[model samples]
Target: MINLNHLNYCYRSGVNVLHDITAEIEPGIHLLMGENGAGKTTLLHIMAGLRYPRTATECTIDDVSTSLRLPSVLSKVFLLTDDMVFPYPTIAEMERYHAPFYPNFDAALLAENLSEFGINPRDSINNFSLGTRKKAYLAYALALRTDILLLDEPANGLDIDSKTVLLRMLSRNITDNQTVIISTHTIWDFQNLFDGVLVLSQGRLVLAEKVWTIVKSLAFVNSLEPISNALYLTQNMGRFQAIVPNDGTLDTAIDYVLLYTALHSPQQSIITQTVKNAR
Candidate 1:
């Protein structure tokens, strides 16, 4: 488990990024959603021990404070940033140089990931395109077999086939011992894969709950006309997509996109009140 206790970050120029954000994330696939400058990347960087908060805060993964950046903590957490650069000429060389840092690095799994992604380990990584480089790094990151896997916009630069392969690999390879936290603006891409939803707004944690719990608390309804008491509504193919309070009989699967929109909409009070009562 990873814990973020009253984290507050700022830059050298004194521009505050994150507020007193606190959340306890359990083992599973977690979707971190927010707007462009909502501090998602900052939070991820702090969790990876790449950045430090201005105030003394607690960010720990399994009792080890991430701020320490010790070998034990570093080996257990892997963060794949959006803008990644590989200096190595080939995948094999990169593997040989960095594999020693991770005790559980699986060379065979790396090869398998390369094969699955249709990438040749002997090919020069510098010559690859942005999407290809992302694939290469993703394979390497997954093969590290770390307990905490943090990915930032992992599906950004990929074709349809590559995205499918990524989804397949994540669905099949994630073990119970590992926790995957994905920070992405495109939440609808893999909504069903997430076990929990975390939404941040203006540097604060606005919503955080298990997907099942959210689904149980609210209902996603589609109708030709607007619902009389919808907490949030959007247009879709001549119909209205709405979020209504679950009355214990509705079993609608939560539309994460709609939930995100509702969290940011003017009528957000309905959702906040209902969620509070449900809890």
Candidate 2:
């Protein structure tokens, strides 16, 4: 498990980016959602043990504190960013140079994932396009076999077919003992992959709940006109997508976009109240 308590971070210019964020993430696929400049990347960096938080803040994975940056902790966690840097020209050379850092790295799995992404393991990495580089990086990341995986904007450079393959590979590869946190603005691309949702707004944790509980607490409705007691609404093609309090009768699938919109609207207080009441 990962535990974050009173986690706060600031830039060198003394501008706060994360404010007292706290959450316990279990072993599962978690989707981290936030608007631009919402501190999602900053938080992911902290989780990856690349950045240190404020003095009073504490962040830990299991019993290990990430701020320590010990080899033992580093070996168990891997962070994949949108912009990746390669020191070697070819995939084979890169793998040879970096594989030692991760004791659990699987070369066979790496080759398999690379092949699935249409990337030749013998191809030179120096001339690869952004999309190709992302694929290579993703394949390497998954092959690390780490206990904790953090991905930022993972689908940014992938084409449609590559994205589908990416999703399929992720779903098939993740084990029950591993925890994966994916921070992305393109939530729809992930669709039904995440089992939990974490939302950050203006550097604060606005929502953190299991997808099942969220769906049970709120109902997403599509109607021609506004419905009474609707928490939030979005117009689409002369129709509306609305979110209302779940009354145990509506079995609608949770619409992440609509739920996110409602959390930022005037009904946020009632939404929070409902969540608290359910607990």
Candidate 3:
């Protein structure tokens, strides 16, 4: 588990990007959701020990303090950012130089993933398109098999077919010992892969809970009209989507987009309270 407490961060220009955030991230695929400039990337950097928190009572991964950036801790964590640049000319060259850093790196898995994405490891990476590059990097990242893998906007440059391949790879590749946190705006693409969610608003952590708990605590429904007692509601394509208290009788699949919208709306407290009471 990743343990954080009272974490705060500020840019060199004196702009605070994160504030007093504390949450435990368990092992699973968790969706990190927030609006633009919500400090998602900053938080990921801190977690990976690439950036230190300005002031934190405690911030550790598996009890190891991340601020120190020790080799022991760093070896088990990998952060794949949106704008990745490789000095190597090809995927094979990159892997040859970098794979040693990650003891668990699986060369076979990398080759398999590359094949699935229709990428040539020997081809110069500079010549590949943006989508192909992203796929290549994703394959390498997954093969690292790090204990903590943080992906920022992982699906940004993918086409429809590539996205489908990505979803399939993620579903089959992640192990129970691994904790993968994906920060993205395209929630619908990987909706089924999320085992939990971490939500940030402005600079604060508003919600951090398992998907099962949220599902048990609330009911997400679709109706012809808005439910008067709904904690939150939104209109979409002439139908109304709503979040209401689960009465132990309603079995509804969560509309993740609607749940995210509700958490950022005025009715956030009501929904949170309902979940807390259930727990």
Candidate 3 ranges beyond 4 A from true positions: 55-57
For 87-120, candidate 2 gives per-residue lDDT tens digits of 7777788788987899989899899999999899
In model 3, what are the clashing residue pairs, if there are any?
A: none
Q: Candidate 1 or 3, higher lDDT?
A: 3
Each prediction's TM-score against the native? 0.95, 0.95, 0.97
Better TM-score candidate (1, 3) = 3
Candidate 3: tens digits of C-alpha lDDT, residues 182-237:
99999988979999899898988888889888888899999997787788988999
- The per-prediction tally of clashing pairs is 0, 0, 0
Deviation in Å, model 2, residue 193 alpha carbon: 0.3
Q: Kindly give the stretch of ten consecutive residues in candidate 2 with the minimal lDDT sum.
A: 270-279
lDDT for model 3 comes to 0.90
Please, what is the whole-model Cα lDDT of each candidate in the order they appear?
Answer: 0.87, 0.87, 0.90
